[model samples]
Target: MQQTVVEHMDRVAEDVVALTLRATAGDLAPWDPGAHIDLSLPNWLDRQYSLCGDPAERDAYRVAVRYDPLSRGGSEYVHRFLRPGRALGVSLPRNHFPLVPAPRYLFLAGGIGITPLLPMMRAAAAAGAPATLVYVGPSPATMPFADDLLRSYGDRVRIVETGRHGRPDLHALAATLPADALVYCCGPATMLAAAEAAFPAERLHAERFQPVARTFGPDTAFEAVCARSGDTVTVPADESLLDALALSGRPLPAGCREGICGSCEITVLDGTPEHRDDIGAPEGRMFPCVSRAVSPRLVLDL
Candidate 1:
C-alpha cells in the first residue's frame, strides 16, 4: 500500500479526468506498460485504472479516469471528491494485459479505453517498433488523448469518431494485419467482441473494464469442499462463492469484485465451474468473486 497525494487533476476530455499523484513517503514502484493500480476510495470501493504515463518516470504516476453516468460510486467519487492535494491509497501495479514482444503491433482503443494503450504505444515507439493505433469514440470531445496521440504519432494514429464519421470498418482493419502482428484492444465489451471476432484468438489481446452479461440457470445452493482443510461450506444462492468461503474462515485474495480483475482466482481440485467473468476462460481455476458452481459440489484447493 502506498499513500499518495493528488498533485494535479485536470479534465483531459469530456467527463474524463487525468490525475497525477506523487508518493507521500518514498519513491513510487516501477511499472511497465499495460500495468494498472488499484485506487482505494472512500466506502471501501476499489477501482483499477491503467498507468498511462511513461514507465521511465518514477517520481509520479498518472492515471486517466472516465466518469460513468451509471457508475457504482468509484468514478463518481473521483470526479466529485478527488482534487488537488487530496490524499488517496493505491496498491502496487499489477499487469494482466502485458504487452508481449512481436514483430508489429495494432492497437484498437475505444473512448477512455485508450488509457492502457497510451503507455504501450509510447513503449513501442521508443523501441523503434512498427505500431499503429485506431482510436474510436462517440465524438472528439469524448475521446481522451486524441490530440496528443495525433501530434506524437502523426499518420500512425487514426481517429474514428462515430458522431462525425460512422463506425470504422473493423473487419477491414483486421484483415490487413500481418501474420506476426499482435492486436491489442481495450474498450467496451462490444468493441472488444468485434476485435475478437475479427482477429485470431491467439493474436488478439484485450482488457475489459466491465463484465459481459451471462445467462445462468436459477441460482441454486451448492457446497464447496476444501481439499487442504477438509472442510465443507455450503454456498447459498444469494451469496457469492468468495463470500461463502470467507464466512467459512477462508478468504481468497480479491481486487475488483465485479470480475474485471482476476484476483479472487482459486484452484478447483474437482468439478466444473460456470465461468462468468469478463477475463474469459479460467483454464483450470475459477474466480470465486463472480463465478459459481455448475455441479452439486465443488472441490477447491483453498
Candidate 2:
C-alpha cells in the first residue's frame, strides 16, 4: 500500500474526472501499459482504475474515472468529495490486461474502457509498431480524452459515436484485421460478447468491469477440505465458498467479492471447480468469492 495525494483533478468529460496522484513520501511504484491500481475509498469501498498516463513518469500516476449514476459509492465519492491534496490509500499496480507482443494490434475500447488502452496506444506508437484504435462511446460530449487522443494519434484513431450511429459492426471490423494481429478489447459485457464471438479465443483478449452471465447450473451444498490445515467445511447451497470458509475459521483475502478481482483465488488440489469468475484463470485454480465446487468434495490448497 502507498499513501498518495491527489495533486491535480480535472473534469475531462461530461461525467468523467481525470485525477493525478503523487506519492507523499517516496516515488510512486512503476507500472507498465494496461496496469491498474486499486483505490481504497471511504466506507470500506475499493475500486480499480486503469493508469491512463505515461508510464515513464514516475512522479505521478494518472487515472480517469467516470461517474456512474448507479455507482456503489466508489465513483460517486471520487466525483463528489475527492479534491486536490486529499490523501488516498492505493494498492500497488496490477496488470491482468497486459499487451502482448504482436506484429500488429487492433484496440477496441467502449466508453471509459479506453482508459487502459490509452497508455497502450502510446507504448505501441513509441515502439513504431503498427497499431490502430477504434474508440466507441455514447456521444462525443461524454467521451473522455477524445481531444487528446485525436490530437496525438490523428489518423490512427477512429471515433464511433453510438448515439449518432448505432453500435459499430465489431464483426465487420474483426474481419478486416490481419491474421496475426492481436485484438484487445475493454468495454461493456455486450461489446465483449460480440468480440468473443467474432474473434478466435487465442487471438482475442479482453477485460471486463462486471461479471458475465454464469454458464453453470444451480448451486449445491458441498464439502471443502483444506489441504494444509486438514480441516473440512461444509459450504451451503445459498452461500459463497469464501463466506463458508470464513465461518469455518479460515478467512481469505478478498477484494471485489463479485468475482471481478482475482484476490481470493485458491488452488484446487482435487475435485472439479465450477469456475464463475471473469478473470479467466485456468483449471486447478478457482475464485472462491463467486465460484463453487462441482464435485461432492473439493480439496483446496489453502
Candidate 3:
C-alpha cells in the first residue's frame, strides 16, 4: 500500500466531491482508463474509487466520489471528514475494465459511474478519437460535474436528468450509437443488463458498479484444486466455488468480492471456466472474482 496526502478537495455537487492527492511515498504507478484505486481510510474502512484525472499524472491522482444515502457512509465520510493535507493509504491503481481500441467509442454512465467516464472522455478527445458519452443522473443538481462535462465536451455529450423526467430511453441510446463503435457502460445492474440485451457482444465493454445476484443454474459440480497449496476443495451445488475456497482459509485475491471487479483473476490449468463477468477476457484464464467452474473438475494456479 502507498500513502498519499490529500492536496486539495472541492465539492462539485451537494453529494459529490473531487479529491486531488499527491503520493507521500514511492512513485505512483501508471493507470489506464477504467482503473480504480482502493483507499484505506483512517476509520479502518476500505473504499474503491475510480481514477478521473489524466492517466499520465502518476504522482498526483484525482477521484470524484458521490455520497449515496443507502451506502454504509463511506462517501459521506470522504465528503465530510476527509480534508486537504490528510494522509491515507491507497493501493496501486488496478484496471479490471479497460477501454479497448476501436474506431469509435460509445460511453454510457449512470450517476456516479460518470466518474470513470470523465477521464476516458478527456483521453478520447485528446486522442482525436470519435466518442460519445451518455450520462444519466437524478437531476442537474444531483449530477456531478454536469457543467464541467458540458463545457468540456459540448455537443458530443448527452445528459439525461431523470429527476424531472422519468427515465432516459435506453432504446434510443442503443439505436443512436454508431454501428462500428465499441460500447462501454458502467452503472447499475439493470442498466448494464439492458445495454447487454440491446447490443449483442460483438464489441461491448461494461463495468458493473454492483454485482447482479446470481441464482445458481443446474450445472455439474466441480472439484477446485489450489495449485500452490495442493489443497483440494469440492464445490457443492449449494455454494459457490469462491465461498468454498474462503471457508477453507484460502482467500482469493479479491476487491469487491462481488465478481464485479477482476482482482481475483486466476490462471486455469484444466477444466472449462464458466466466464460470468463483463471484464476483459484473456485467453485460457478465468476471473474467480465472479466466475464459476462449468466442468466437473478444475485446477487453479492460486
Write down the TM-score for model 1: 0.89
What is the per-residue lDDT of model 1 for residues 30-111, given as tens digits with 9 covering 90 to 100? Answer: 9999999988886578888999998888878999999999988989999998879988888888788999988789999999
Candidates in descending lDDT order? 2, 1, 3
* Model 2 pairs in collision: none
Full-model lDDT for every candidate: 0.89, 0.89, 0.80
Better of 2 and 3 by lDDT: 2
Q: Candidate 3, 168: how far from true, in Å?
A: 3.3
Which residues of candidate 2, in runs, are more than 4 Å off?
none
Q: Model 2 misses residue 39 by how many Å?
A: 1.2
Candidate 3 off by > 4 Å: 173-176, 218-223, 233-250, 274-281, 289-292, 295-297
TM-score of each: 0.89, 0.91, 0.84
lDDT (C-alpha) at residue 141 in model 3: 78
lDDT, residue 177, model 3: 74
In model 1, which residue pairs have backbone atoms overlapping below 3 Å?
none
**Per-residue error (Å), model 3, residue 288:** 3.8
